[model samples]
Target: MIPQIRSRVLWIVMSGLVLLLASVHLMIGGLDQHEEKSQRLRFLPDGHFLRTASLGYRELTADVLWLQAIQVMGERKVSPEAGRWIYRLLDVVTTIDPKFTWAYEAGGIALCTLVVLPEESNRLLEKGMLHNPEEWKFPFLLSINYAFELGEDAKAAEAMALAAQLPGAPSNLGRLAANFFVSAKAPQQAIDLLSDLYEKTSDPGTKSLLGERLKRVAVERDLQLIEGSIARYRQSHGGLPSRLEDLTTSGILEKLPIEPYGGRYEYDPHSGTVRSSEISERMTLSMKRRRDSL
Candidate 1:
């Protein structure tokens, strides 16, 4: 009886140890397989095939694929084929889960920034709009693509109008939309749009881009004001002034506007034009040549 009891206890302990070892092996195998999958994700089956294979876990499978897509896009260097690869990955993720609005937004913005493909970005955002009619972000992004890349302020205004009408949208979007519709040529309107976009976006890349654009527009606006003041100074004084300071000294301007990039304004008597001192000499010469041509 004692021998039988000891044999039973030993059998139970050995079985538990076997089970623990088996579980550890399974976990290590799963990690290995996951790493392999991530490395070879580009060679995976297409969305249609994966969808069919998801076994009723379409959304879950898509979530995983979307994460992989993000990894692929962020890690990949800029190569000729990188854009195409990113588009394919994003397309697959969207195809599997059409209602994933964040995926669409990220993909659209990535296409624009990474690939410089505004048309493709527009198509992706438009598709997101169709899937998420009640969501305002898609149309807002579409407006950005149109205004910045395509230079279609009218279309941008229309899209912004749609965005403003959507639930949860900001009340001030209407004013920005109206500005875009009223004038395609107004730098102020561009500035307003960019400022709004810069504030609304949390993405560092998009915010940086908007900041640069805003600086350019602000510089342009200051240049216009300086030019007008210069004209007024010449009208009163009977010739171009010796320097930009003369405009302020003669009361044409209260004080010269501060340069957007922290450089003093310079006046060229030979060209009868004012330029920002911060502008590179190359850019100054290019602008002078363009004015001469015009």
Candidate 2:
């Protein structure tokens, strides 16, 4: 009976030890995984430091760093801190190999869209533009970031204008740039862009389209000035103007604006609204585009 009790007690103690060891192993594994995930992209030094250490194998260094960057991107969750770290890694890669065009473009896009870090994204793209001036995609991408992400129409127009001037740029870039300028309330800039396009493009259809667009934007510009004067007149007189001429007669406008498209400005006294015979849908299109972007 004594031998039987001792055997049972030993079995129970051994089973408890085995279970305790398994639990400890699982706890250690969980702790290790958590620590590994918590580690962000701080494994690399900055760009300048890596450049000095590359030992003249700059391209090789860049390639290795790029692989690491992609690995982290695939594994980590999208976050601003992670985006910034990725930017740093790409910056190091570019520093080692300035001609790495895809790194600049891809890194910029990832930073902007995935992490919503515009400043870092633009910085990477600007570096690309600096290194590769002939690459129209950089400036085109800049236009997208500025127009849609940052909501800076003038900056977008400028970037898109540069893109349109480059070889192999899309044909619609010019029209889009003009629209951005007009959306920024710089109608003359739009008119100038369309005028430039008209002079350069040999296609008759495109030429005619540019001509019509230029005339329409000019009419819009004049309307903007006239309506502003009418609003001022209403504010001073406490009533709507009876005619378009009332604006100048009331000393609000220096002169009646001439319509650039051989069209006349029509004023509605009841609603105090102004329209042109050459009513361009540019403003409406621009408004819709802005709304869709939001």
TM-score winner = 1
TM-scores, all candidates, are 0.56, 0.50
lDDT of 2 by residue, 1-294 (tens): 999999998777666545533443343224325654234443445666556555455676677667666655554356666677778878888987889977876676666544556668788989999999998867866766676456678998999999989987767778888888886555665456456656766744334434654565577678778878888998899999998888877788878978776778888999987887755343424445656889
Candidate 1 TM-score to native: 0.56
Q: Which candidate should be chosen as best, given lDDT against the real structure?
A: 2
Query: Whole-model lDDT, candidate 2?
Result: 0.69
The lDDT, on a scale of 0 to 1, for candidate 1 is 0.68
Q: Can you tell me which runs of candidate 2 are displaced by over 4 Å?
A: 1-41, 184-294
Report model 2's TM-score to 2 decimal places: 0.50
Model 2 worst lDDT window (10 residues): 23-32
Local distance difference test, per candidate? Answer: 0.68, 0.69
Instruction: Give candidates' CA RMSD values in order.
Output: 11.1, 18.3
Find the 10 residues in a row with the least total lDDT in model 1: 279-288
